[model samples]
Target: MQALYDVPAPAKLNLFLHVIGKRPDGYHLLESIFALIDWADTLHFERRGDGLLQRHDSEGANLPPDDLCLRAARALQQASGCGFGADIHIDKRLPAGAGMGGGSSDAASTLLALNRLWGLDWSLQKLKELGLSLGADVPFFLGGTHAFVEGIGEILHPVTLPEQRFAVVKPAASIATKEIFSSSLLAMSKSVAIVAGFPAHNSSENKTVDVTRYLDGFGKNDLQKAAEAASDDVVQALELLETKFGNSRMTGSGSAVFARVVQENGKSDPAMATMLQEAIPAGWQGRICRSLEHHPLKGWARD
Candidate 1:
């Protein structure tokens, strides 16, 4: 095929993030569950025989000149020694600096799409290895399912989570990942017995698991305190969601916080969206997002 259209690159929510320790290399060791959400960015790819990698963004998007999509495509080309090229267009939807892994997801999608567009037919493992070079979270996106992530975000253990909805909010302000991690307020948690507490359930199974039993009082984003201190908007977003939903937590790092939407009679509360729309302040973004069992492009690459 010469072109691939309407390929999706979904965002992720850090159901819970903990800073266990710091690696000698200055990377923080983390343990968290990265849950895919339906909120996504769309990408289109057209094969280019002229051996040139290009990226186009939606009008008024004003993306960075050297965004992850271009970086991912170049990296793949160099790694595979492929002479082919592609023109990638991004329909940007996810917010930046929301701690939602938007850019990483885009990069992962680019790699997966280019692999097919170029007919490289690379294995999933190969793509993931190349993906890690792009960013820590890129590998998780390539993993293609909700996963229990560890070890600076490279390790992935696919876990089954019951279908659920979340109320997600992103404030007008943004916080840098480095700023959150470098803050003195950042706290580290004692390494817990993740293997013992985290149940190992296959994502392929149709059975339901009571995720709340483990997540109810589980770990939190250790970076939230630092982020709140950095941006008053973070504090506002957290309070806004917590006040309305009865509980809220910052995902990944900061600026975006989410709360689990309680279902009524086995159906999502219809009023959740209205509540979010009214409660969130002007210039902020909110959505009622459903958890995904797997990424939309799952299995795009050979296993």
Candidate 2:
């Protein structure tokens, strides 16, 4: 039996999400930078000779019968005419409905891993097209870099982002994307601007500069208002983070909130996330996350 062990699917944060307009079909036009973070979900795969796709959870009993991992495998199988199937086991770390793009990342990882495992050697562009059919966020995960995303997520341009530490909080609440997108309270944000030394364009060739202050006033999450209204847990989580970190924003129509950790008293500390955790409710989960320059699988495929 052939297998891949301990493969990772990293999570992402939306530095800022701005809704510029709406499509004729009612999908929203967006301008946002998706940043990869160190937080990730791990997956293990073993090839099955019987052409049967199966899944299991190492942690015992959390995954559903039908999930994106299964769908992704099936999609790739149908696309490349591969006759082999595999057993996919996921060790889920990122929470669901947290707006951290966990499921999409898992799905993308499945496609990439299987493409290699099955020896199809599909190009990144071909995989991305398959990913898009799976989900809008899937392409961004496939792209494997911080990106300037637009056009309801079909368009992507790699962007250089500053490295900074962020504290994330996910209250005991699940936010449904469909519910938030359909809300009447959702509104469009005008535009986004960077402060200090950051470059204005989203390109790989562009110079990289510190964006510590760029995120301070970057822009508002267009869905924040609607998310807060939909989930009182989200409202409380943001309020708690804001009280300690000065400003807090929800990531990707989620109940999860995040704030930058700044130096205090002329000294920088790595344990500040612990301090931030002390301020939040014990029932909520908190962690310090560092932004990644690119996704772990960035080199796996070509665009």
Question: Which candidate number has the best TM-score?
Answer: 1
lDDT of 2 by residue, 50-151 (tens): 888999886753777888989999999998889888988888888888999998999999988888788888999899999999989999998877876777
User: Where is the poorest 10-residue window by lDDT in model 1?
Assistant: 200-209
lDDT of 1 by residue, 79-175 (tens): 9999888888889989898999999999999999899999999999999999998999999999888887778988777767878689999999989
Winning candidate number (lDDT): 1
Give TM per candidate. Answer: 0.92, 0.89
